[model samples]
Target: MHEAVLGIEHPGAYSSATAGTDTTVELWCNDHCDLLHVGGSEAESVVAHVEDAVGVRERIAEGDERLLITDACLKEHGDDPIEATLAEHDCLLVPPLRYAEGRKWCRVLALDAGNLTAFYRDVSAEFPVVVDSKREVASVRADRPLLTLDSALPDLSPRQHEALLTAVEMGYYRIPRDATTAEVAGKLGVERRTFEEHLRRAENKVVAGLAQYL
Candidate 1:
């Protein structure tokens, strides 16, 4: 087994060098600006190690770290299968992990009831990021039209396929939102948390797919 490493990591440098079997789990607790960046890599017990470190992260954040997870987002994604899977190892679920040129998103996770709860999920494709020596946040806003569903929609996993369509049908993204998380959760016959995870993973995949066009 590889030796375990835990640290606050940025993938920009590591992306090109990362190899398969190089298991690095990056975790952030709370939303907005994540004060705590908990991660572990190169360990057989990565999940367990992260769980333990997250406690310290939580404690530290209690003092120096600041970010408040929204209850609505928690209710949206806390009970996903991934959440349960990580919870078994004492790892809380965080927001979707993504890497690309212009977009940035932030999400949060925490340990509660010995279970990992996730919340404060946000997605920003045109997020501002410091670029080059000039230190200007890059803006790649496409006031362009939404691409046709045929070309833009990603190849979905069975579960993602269901979740995205469900969100649309329920009007979760519609103006004046027609369905709340709880209502959509019921319609999908999933716990409010489970549905949220599904939705999160689904959205991540879609965004990741679209990012290829950049």
Candidate 2:
């Protein structure tokens, strides 16, 4: 697999107008359309414009500073071409496409080097595409690159990790409880007391590790 950072030009995108100005718009994809996380001094102006936008829909907002926006990619308004092209090539766009100087800078996870190359060719043909970084995904060193629970709590013993994951999947942590400790224990072929022991120990480690940050 390959991971590459790309900068795509978004001409006439609502983001383009706000770029390198006062407002900063960071975007990611939902089921459909781009989700915008907005901030900066001119945030209110960006919200006002997107609220009335024909192809854009504003879902909810904490304030003008943070909002969820959906771009319908309507043809008439020159919606971004980068997304659709990436989709066709089976490349995944990493979250938070940042706007700066009229470009949408984002990271893409390509299934293979060929896919990344193909995406580059297809996208660069229409708009300027800058390859900021390119490398084998395994070559990238990050403290918690995959962002899994295990990465967050590296001190967890193997048994504790398994118990915790099973507990979560069986809804042992859910409100009103979808599953019980006994049921979880049976699934893991352990005594209910044993499962509880592992779970409690794991939970304590997690809470203690997180509490300092809070």
Candidate 3:
């Protein structure tokens, strides 16, 4: 497998409003539509800017995090050359696009390394795509049996990783629970339920991954 990363500026309302700010926007796409999580001290301001700019009326809030919608139609206007190039080459997106400072960063995992050159060519021709870096993942040899124990490590999102690490250091998992979920959440600047939910999900992934080989 090969991992290709590209960074490009977005002319959309969300990224434009967040540029040079502490606002963070994490984006995932489903059926070619965007699902956005906008969070930070300036989250509300960012949301307002996007809503006003795009004339979107829908909003969904999850604890301290807010979900906002983006105009998928904007991509057709050459805003999302990365996604378009991936579709053309049938490449898989390993990670969702990350937005910061008005730029969209994406990492894709491709089965055929040769696809990257074609994909890059198309994107560069169509949009102002910046090639951040590219590297090949060393494939495991079929003759050597690899241990499954390493799979015990959880596949955590950035937020989940932070929550888990904080809980552990604060002795949240210790006897009698030294740290309350609220306290931990406060320390992380998120809601208590949000912290607990992320922690539970992380624990579940770790347990399931470990138990599979047992």
Candidate 4:
């Protein structure tokens, strides 16, 4: 099996709310409605923008999150490229598609690398797309237990995962600290401040996820 994280420059009401802001939105949708978890300092403004977006039948806000009953599923929009391409390629999207900084991030699984590649190509034709990560995984066995590292780990954004991996590879966490934040940031082609932010978030997620075991 093959899995990948794809970042797509899709234009939508949620994307518009996240553009030029630190806000992040995670969405789960069906045929009728969408549930969104909004996070960041600007979540209130983000929810307000979503309320005014076309096709929203009704909205309920609870703290920083929102439940939206919509006329149509966002994925089923006439012009959306994801849902159709996914079906054509026989790929599956892992839920909670993420939106941040005007891009939609999706985690997709495919039977093989070829199908994943074709799916990426088709989606890229419609919108700017970036393959953030890709890997081949062992095929699942019917008798095997469900609990695993992948399931236990928290889902980190592509940038956060990249930042954490880069830091580790550069020996940022070594006893002697072979690399500094500036060095790791330079390696990743990002500002030091931005790199630090991603690394911190990644660390927090990982630590929090493992706290119970510790």
Residue pairs with colliding backbones in model 1 are: 76-196, 79-193, 103-125
lDDT of 1: 0.39
> Tens-digit lDDT track for model 4 on 1-214?
8889898998888887888776778888876667676765477888777666636676677543455656566655446668779989999988778888788888898988899999999889889988877877775657752234755776665577889999999999999999999999999999999999889978987997899878
The CA lDDT at 168 in model 2 is 97
Query: What stretches of model 3 exceed 4 Å from their correct place?
Result: 31-33, 53-64, 69-79, 124-214
How do all models score by TM-score? 0.30, 0.52, 0.51, 0.67
State the C-alpha lDDT per candidate: 0.39, 0.69, 0.68, 0.79
**Which rank order by lDDT, best down to worst?**
4, 2, 3, 1
Number of the top-ranking candidate, with lDDT as the measure: 4
- Supply candidate 4's per-residue lDDT for 98: 84
Task: Give the alpha carbon lDDT tens digit for every residue of 59-166 in model 2.
Answer: 565533566656553234455568788898999987656664566676788878999899889888988877767777654348646443332442454467779999
| Candidate 3: C-alpha lDDT | 0.68
Model 1 spans with C-alpha error above 4 angstroms: 1-153
Model 1 lDDT per residue over 166-206, tens place: 98998999999999988888998989987887787678767
Best model per TM-score: 4
Clashing pairs in 4: none
> lDDT: which is higher, 1 or 4?
4
Clashes of each: 3, 0, 0, 0
* Candidate 4 least-lDDT 10 residues: 139-148
